[model samples]
Target: MSPFPFLSLLNWAKTQGRHSLPWRAYFHLSIKDLGYHIWLSEILLQQTQVERVIGYYDHILEHFPTIESLANASYEEFFPYYQGLGYYSRARNMLETAKIVTEEYGGIFPNNADELIKLPGVGPYTAAAIRAFVYDEPLLSFDTNLEKIFSRYYHGNRFRKLTQKEKTLLEKDFRDTGISGREMNAAFMDFGSMVSLNIKPSDDNKWKKNTKDYPLSDCLWLKTHGTLEIREKKKKTVFPTKDASIIVVLHENHRIYYSSTEGEYQSFLLPPTENDIRHAIQDFFRSKFNLELSVRPIHDKYFENDRPFVVCNAQVQKGDTLFAKYRKENGFFVENT
Candidate 1:
């Protein structure tokens, strides 16, 4: 095993870890509610920032209030709360898991990893998190942060998964250090996120130079090895931009309209099109919102992909009940332009 100071890591976590996160706040609640909250928080946190998740987590807890409430809500009812949080699948999976838990487990969350993994969206990392945080079980939750820590400390670089041997060494280190699993996992996450960040080469070196006050200063690859070799950065992909259009739908009283589409990044704007701008806007409104809109070009510009796009503004037809109903049902909210 690498001669890293695992005990130092645990000591750092005791004073510096993010112990006040939303999920951790729920630990003092009822056991049934504790599992549900932790599960929801873990799923929401995947590939998302903690700052962004705080509001969403609070809103979801306020609306759903319990696992049964979330399970009983329809997709339409639930999708609103999850709007703008990319990864729609996570929300859908959470609904499915809630239903399963309510029906199969009598509303009590399963304590073991095997049973927890059967729930939708509960991957290995999330399952371990639930066991560790909610049940206080001694299990490792290997997230991206921990992955970076282990990969760099063990291999002196990243872009790889931990080998079985590395996993064993880590487990043994944790055990021998007398650190509980939850504390160890939390320490790795905090240390990796706050202290051992993988930045651009210049910033990485600067961060290394200031490591005297950082947690587990000697264990960092840059400190131990005096240098770090990063994997080659991936080349940026260039997409040939065809003609595209962004529709700005405006309702009465200065209300601006927006909708979300599924993709790698959740887009508030409609699809990019190569057809005639007017026809494309008409078709998009008809197909997606089932309403025909007359749009006028506001601006024409080229975006990052080097494609020409027209930003068109349209007004909601007077007394259009269908448009109003669609807006309400789809949870469309207005933003001031």
Candidate 2:
């Protein structure tokens, strides 16, 4: 509402902000190098916490080192590093984008937003980010953080989409501010994350006090709406808990039988049995893999899920041809525990 809240936000960020992030450290590098780092860091940060991604970013840089290296690496080689990162599709897209950049752009990233958006996994926000941070382009990257700050400052509905006129006004404001788009973006993000947070009902007053201390002159929301209302937290739906016996069928040659299920735990798991788990394992092996194999229970553990599952491990009979065949074809190898 200050026509430029970014001035105060940027000033605040200089003293207290997330400036030490690994991606920000690459700002001094050449555009090509900076683009690669920013692209990788942005993709990795998606749906993941900054704390979780920092080590992963460093490790990925160690492995890939460059766009060409990332492009050349096989899924088998890359996926292991990305194992605990949850969203495998993002990693896949990153690999694909790296290949596109290397093959089409000759290892140089596209500087402009339009061309950058054409690359795999690079959306509007990501493209704007790359353009602003790496190419110094004056594009507004409307991430969730910026959206909240703008909505609060301008008395706009946080949940509603911005109209064309609103968008034009925001663009014009940015143009008139004279602050670097990169710094402005960072300032808004830091302000939203640190100060004017989306907090619970009871915490609204505390946040309102903090906002008043910051003192934005034209904040229509503070003037009109008064104290920021507490955002109602969504009710978490409780799922029915279920118990299952998970089988970790290990062969004599140290190859473990793993299943490729598309769920939280992507491995061979079975329901709990009243009788012997070994007999159940044998039945599963004979039915699913078409193999006659003996099995014995190794250990049992519980896995937390929508429906909590009880996982039980079992060792399979050695000399099963199907196990070897599946392992060879699918590369479904896990350490025999």
Task: Enumerate clash totals for all models, in the order shown.
Answer: 0, 5
In angstroms, how far off is 135's CA in candidate 1?
Answer: 1.3
lDDT of 2 by residue, 94-155 (tens): 88999999999988788777888888789989988888777766668887767766776776
Question: CA shift at 202, candidate 2, in angstroms?
Answer: 4.7
**Residue 56 alpha-carbon offset, candidate 1, angstroms:** 0.5
For residues 1-337, write the lDDT of model 1, one tens digit per residue: 6655777878888888888876767446987898888888889989888889999999999999999999999877997788767655577788999999999988778888899998988888999898887777766787767777777766666656788877777766666665566666677777776778555555656665666577655454655452565555899865333445464544332333433432221222556666666567667667766664445554445565655454655543312323221133246443222
Best by TM-score: 1
Worst 10 residues of 2 by lDDT: 317-326
Clash count in backbone of candidate 2: 5
CA lDDT, candidate 1, residue 228: 61
Candidate 2 CA-lDDT value: 0.68
Cα error of candidate 2 at position 218, Å: 4.5
Model 1 bad stretches (over 4 Å): 200-205, 208-210, 224-226, 232-237, 242-288, 291-337
TM-score between candidate 1 and the true structure: 0.69
